[model samples]
Target: MIVVVGITVGILDVCELGSHFILMSITIACGMLSEAYARGPPAPNASTHHSERQIPFAACDIAQLLIALCWGITGDIAEIVSRARIAQLWAATGVAVAYMSIARWLGNVIIFDRKKSRFVANAVYGLAFVPYATSWCALIARFALAINGAEASVPDWIIAIVIGMFFGFTGTFPIIHALSINRVIDVDAAEVAYAIAGVANKSLLGWYMWYGVNRMQTA
Candidate 1:
């Protein structure tokens, strides 16, 4: 709950990690106050580790920061084009993967509800990857522009949606499946569904999606 709420706060603003911590403290303090005032029975299960494990709080935080930092690269693509830039974008993504791995490790080691970790972490991480992908798209667009010149003409919003949906599908859906929806209990059903409609569907669909994104440049 706290982690999800914190992530939600972060999503609302780029500077939310700090704000989330502060907000959490205030909320905890208020909850304590309310508990103290109650003259009747005890409060709810406040003793349990949130998600049933010791969340790699620092690790998860670092992951979010790492992700945000990777996103910061979009700001530098132009410099990259004319200067020294390598196709090391995967490195940026790796940092995020490590963090997510840490979170999962925390979940398993601590006996946290695996399901919870699956959903929240997936949603957060998957959605998070979009900016990084966008950075690449922008870099690509810049290169295309440089070659073709004259604006090369394109619609950014379309690119935004394609990029957004790509990450959303690639990252989010599987996580939602493995974690939140607990698809393992119904493997056959999941396969049928994913085969026909899920992201597991194929690269052509992905390419189609990417093509739509390219149209953004002309839009």
Candidate 2:
């Protein structure tokens, strides 16, 4: 229902503001919910065995890495040489982070059987859309751009790598939580796996983005 409403409003421009982000959040939230349902209820005597505990965390880590790589490459390809590129990257990152956070929150609420007031749940859902209209993501992008401006001739690949790494690292927490909610892995082991995957993903994406950017800059 939440997903359907969000998609409808986004398509119809019912809110006319930040509909993209709202739709994204709703999609992610729904994905999490579906996964939780697929996993069914936790066993009453569920015990975390060593191998069982490791598998989901490992899988989540791999999934996050792939997701990060895809996003990073897409951003790199979309980036223009103007200052607006920074803003674009930041906005994209903010949306990704927001989606992950909302999904994780929803998953946690479902998994733990915690009750939330309708107002509170709606408020949490609203957080995903806030970044779309907020200046904070842009501000952060500006700060980052300013720091990087000192080195004008830095290779495009180097810049790509740095941006990918930053966003990838920042996004890990929520990814882990989402995985946990899906019962993919125990939450406690998620940090290490997700971190490792983030690093790998970002590093590869940086190289790939660099290649693309270099080609464009030289052309």
Candidate 3:
């Protein structure tokens, strides 16, 4: 399944190795996050709670950063034009990914009762995606401008709005956690859903952004 998805995505004009490798990494990361949460922290307590969350979150973040670093270092911009500009874009994305990752773990630690509170938990966690979404929107704009040598596409704004909403949706994992905490959803089901969302956000959306950029760059 991973290979199939990777090959499909790699069909786009880009660095095939980097694209395939990153897609595979994201798939594995999604599974790791789901499994880790499903197992429910090695020891759940106030003192160790933050640590448990940080480990898996950090692993996923590292995987994302690795791909960004690979593209930046290797000049692997999908279209191969303006290597310097694309490198800057990847650098910015790396920073945003790091910010988003930090916000995830820290938000959970700072916002107590994240799994218990109905509204506050979901709201707080959802805000963490702000950086991630914003970066991508900007990336799209700048990338389009670079490729077209003109104003960014008007449709880019629509894509930006959709990306924002999508990230907002992704951050609602606290709801899933709450469901598991209250036993409203069985642990297995919650984990499976969580894994699906993780894959969608990290792997699917990431590919969408890259593919979009590739199309613009090549067109």
Global lDDT of each model?
0.34, 0.40, 0.40
RMSD of each: 18.4, 17.5, 16.3
In model 2, the runs with Cα more than 4 Å from the true position are 1-21, 47-55, 58-61, 73-77, 82-219
lDDT of candidate 1 over 162-208, digit per residue (tens): 43344334533333235226633233222222221221112222333
Worst 10 residues of 2 by lDDT: 50-59
Tell me the deviation in Å of residue 198 in model 1: 22
Collision pairs in model 1:
52-112, 153-217, 154-217, 154-218, 155-216
* CA RMSD (A), model 2: 17.5
lDDT of 3 at 178: 62
